[model samples]
Target: MLYHTSPNYLSSQITDNDQLLFQKKKTNDLKEKKDAAKQKLAKVTFACREEMLKLREQKAQVQLEKLTKRKDKIERLIKLEHEIRELNAKTFMRIKPMHNPTTTTLYQNIVNIFYYMMVAIVILGFTYGMTKIAISTFDSLQNNQLTIIAAETNLFKLKEGVSDIFETKKVTTSYSFES
Candidate 1:
């Protein structure tokens, strides 16, 4: 190939070199801007991750504190319930001893009085029955003795009358069969 060297072509070749140098400078500026943007994004991502970790730790701490408070409250409630039960037991003990004896004695005295009254009534009934039996027996014995006397008198009169009718002169004495 035969080379043709022209002055205009040589000037155009210098201008093309200058344009290439400008394009290269523009490319370097764009690359620096891209690198700076990437660095800013990396910093922002790291800060966000750190803040998220801090939030998680704070939430865990809050939950732990809540659990501890709940446990303390439960313990206090249990202690209060136990104290109440103990107080109730003591009160019952004191009241039981204080009240039981008087009522028991009262009931026992009433029962004793009733028993004595029943015994007296039974004794009186027995005495009355015995008196009635004695009175009836004495009355029957008196009536029988009177009837025997009457029968003896009748027998003596009849014997005298028969003796007179037969005109008997036998020697007779009073018959004595009494022992």
Candidate 2:
């Protein structure tokens, strides 16, 4: 009875050991699957980070190109403004007068000479006309005075003839009485 019982106890112990070994193998398989998943997640995160950096670099390049174009445009506008100012200055110079002082003075002198000559001629003509008028007036006054004297002498002679006629009439009458 003791020997038989010992064999039974040994068989039970071996079965229990086999069950523990199978459980340990299952746990190891689960742990390996979890580690593989973690590795895959890390690789994906690294790829995403690299893509974001590339996008940022492209944006910076585009901004630099825009700024360069704006600078070029401003420089062109400044050049154009400078050219316009120069043209305006040249035009103003051309528009200004270019008079010759000598020629202008000569023309003025000629005009003054003509004006003086005209004034002298007018004064001479006025003087000559006044002299002629004075001479004609003097001759007319002398003729009037001579005509008045001749008329007075004729009146005196008529008065004397009348007086002699009256005296003769009176003497004839007295002689008639004496006779």
Candidate 3:
């Protein structure tokens, strides 16, 4: 066909060849439309894929954030556990020396230290388990799966354990919850 270029965006009128080409183009418009539709579909598919990749990346970021928080919490809990253990040992050693306190003081300190150690150990275990569950739930949330919904029950169990441990000590201390 005839070919031409414009200095600006304007164009020349039709020649015989241009007319023939225009006729041919009209005849082939249906095929062009089909080609256009196929191109549109390809573009849409690519767009969908890009969106999927973005979502996956977002999920990965969320997972990374949760992992970072869990790492921090784990480090703190480990430090606290270590400190409690050391304190328990120190308190035990100090209480065992009767020359240190002959009155009921040594006995009370020993009992308190033992119970405190037990509480710390139990709490540490629960903390680790809960952290693991929280990480797992993050995974499940990203994957759109079921997650643990037993936090209340677990808290109740911990409370019961605390009560049971102190039952024999006749400790009737009332605990208050803050909103």
Candidate 4:
């Protein structure tokens, strides 16, 4: 009876020890799983933050580019406007001559008269040159006709002389025959 009681007590003590060890092992495994999960979550959060920062930087860069483009456009427009203003000022100066209307008109009229006079002179010179050419051509043609007439007259005189000599020879032959 004493041995049986001792064995029962030893068995109960062993069971209690096993249960405690099992509970401790389970707690340790759970803690390890929680730590791993926290690490994974931390990595995911860090990646998300980096991505957000990159996106923000890209957005800022795009905005800066847009602003620069707008600034350039505005500057070009301003330059063009300034150039236009300068051109207008120059145009105003050019038109200032019209402030004295009578003088401007008189000058313009003088220039127009000169231009017309030059044109008339050119036309008169052309007419004179053509007339000279025509007169010279007429004179040359008249001279050629005179030369041809003179040649014809000389040829006629030669033929008459030859006929007269032949007649004289016939007369002489007749006298000789009579003798």
The best candidate in terms of TM-score: 4
Lowest-lDDT window of 10 residues in candidate 4?
94-103
Local error of candidate 1 at 2, Å?
7.8
Report the Cα lDDT for residue 119, model 1.
86
- Against the true structure, whose lDDT is highest? 4
Q: What TM-score would every model get versus the actual structure?
A: 0.43, 0.40, 0.39, 0.49
Off by over 4 Å in 4: 1-5, 98-179
Instruction: State the lDDT of candidate 4 residue by residue for 15-87, as single tens digits.
Output: 8888888888888888999999999999999999999999999999999999999999999999999999889
Across 1-179, the per-residue lDDT of candidate 2 in tens digits comes to: 67657966778767767777777777777777777777777788888888889888889889888988998999999999999988965654333223323323434555655777898899999998999888888888777777767777777776777777778887776654453
lDDT of 3 at 24: 89
Collision pairs in model 1: none
Q: Is candidate 1 or candidate 4 better by TM-score?
A: 4
Over all chains combined, what TM-score does candidate 2 have?
Answer: 0.40
lDDT of 1 by residue, 1-179 (tens): 12336777777878888889999999999999999999999999999999999999999999999999999999999999999988965654333233245323435555656777998999999999999988988888888778878887888888888877655534444455888
How does model 1 fare in lDDT? 0.79
